[model samples]
Target: MKENLKRLFEYRELLFNLTRKEVKVKYKNSFLGFIWSLVTPLMMLVVFYVAFGVIFKLRAMDMKYYAFYLMAGILPWNFLSQTLTQGVASVVMNSDLVKKVYFPREVLPLSYLGSASFHFLLQEAMLIVFLLAFRVPLTPWIFMLPVLMLLEAVFIAGLTLLLSTLNVFFRDVQHFTEILLMAWFWMTPIVYPISQIRDNLPAWAAKLYMLNPMTHIVLMWQRITYNSPVNGPASYSMSPAGVIGTVACSLGLLIVGYVTFTRLEGRFAEFI
Candidate 1:
């Protein structure tokens, strides 16, 4: 593992270059280019706000700046979704390079993650701009954005490495990931508040829901970006135990994923 870490470090430049390529290639021929990144979350915000905030009346429940709340969760969720969707197929998509190259195989998924992270940051900035435009108060907790992003990234990188490695062997893993993410999105408290789960579900069921790692991560995003005092105590759902568990889960997954990726990477060429 130490040797793998040293070797991956040695190829850091390669990772950066590949990440750059992924970002550029993403919008290579598009007329809107990077604007689409901002546009996508904006569109989601509008649709969800109309559906939940307007139609469902979630905002009537004292959820101030509900659009901001939606964006807070949606942006990070999109980051994870895009990373998995693209990263799963990354190794197979670059079979020629994989067969010819001697560099770290992990770079492929990490590069896609880098590209998604770029868009995630841009969307988050756009969200902040919207907040300022609407005269919403900013809090000291907003400074913790980078820390939250890093935690989410660690969780994503682990999943990407593990899934991408397996994807090379089983093409179905890529397709399965898409379906899984679709279900996973609704399972996390993105479109709705976490309070709904606690209030609506039985205690045991709510406890099971909290077991989702993304649940804590998304709630933390909502807590940092959306949970103003005016939004009430219900909006503030993150607990110390949840934070500790999330950090432990993220680190554990990264280690397990890295070990799995490295062990199977030797057989990747054969499978691909």
Candidate 2:
């Protein structure tokens, strides 16, 4: 682990190169370039806001519409989606680098994901501007944002390593992971609140929901976004148990992924 960290520190140049390359490739030929990130989430929020907030009049406590509710969900969801999608194909996509490079294999995927994570932060900065426009108060809990982002980075890095390594063994990893992400997205409380589903589903359903780490993280985000009482229900809320579970799961995945990738990395060039 120390050696891997040292190698990443030594190869910082390649890391920056990968991140810049990804940003360039993603925005290449696009008129708006990076603005496309804002467009995607904003359009999504509008559609859901109208459908659930306007058409259905579905409201969650004090959150009258989906826009406020969704920025919380969308931000975290986007990070997970982009990380998994890009990570799955990282090794296969960088077959050239994998075959020729002497550095850590995880760095490539980490760089791609690091770029995505930066974009997520950029999206959050945009969200904060919207929050101020709506007059959302600046509360003490807002300090938790950096802690959450660090936790999020660890989670993404772990998953990215797992999928990138797997893709070499199974070329279909990308296709299947997308389907998994879609199923996982719906499993999360994106379009509606947990209370909305609670009455409709059984206790078992709620337990199943906790299996999704994003469920806890997104809800916590919503609570912070609203500047409501921490770990308490007041127009917004979160289950401390749930968020703890998410962190535990994330760490477990990171350890598993790191071990698995290093174990299998030496064969990547031969397979790819």
Which has the greatest TM-score?
Answer: 1
Query: What residue runs in model 2 are displaced by over 4 Å at the alpha carbon?
Result: 60-62, 227-237
Q: Estimate each model's TM-score.
A: 0.96, 0.91
TM-score of 1: 0.96
**Pairs that clash in candidate 1:** none
RMSD list, candidates in order: 1.5, 2.5
Across 51-115, the per-residue lDDT of candidate 2 in tens digits comes to 88778877545554357668878887898888888888988988897788778887778887878
lDDT of 1: 0.88
List candidate 1 stretches off by more than 4 Å: 228-236
lDDT of each: 0.88, 0.79
What TM-score number comes out for model 2? 0.91
Residues 105-197 of candidate 1: C-alpha lDDT, one tens digit per residue: 999999999989999988888888888898887766889999999999999999999999889888999999999999999999998877788
Q: Highest lDDT: which candidate?
A: 1
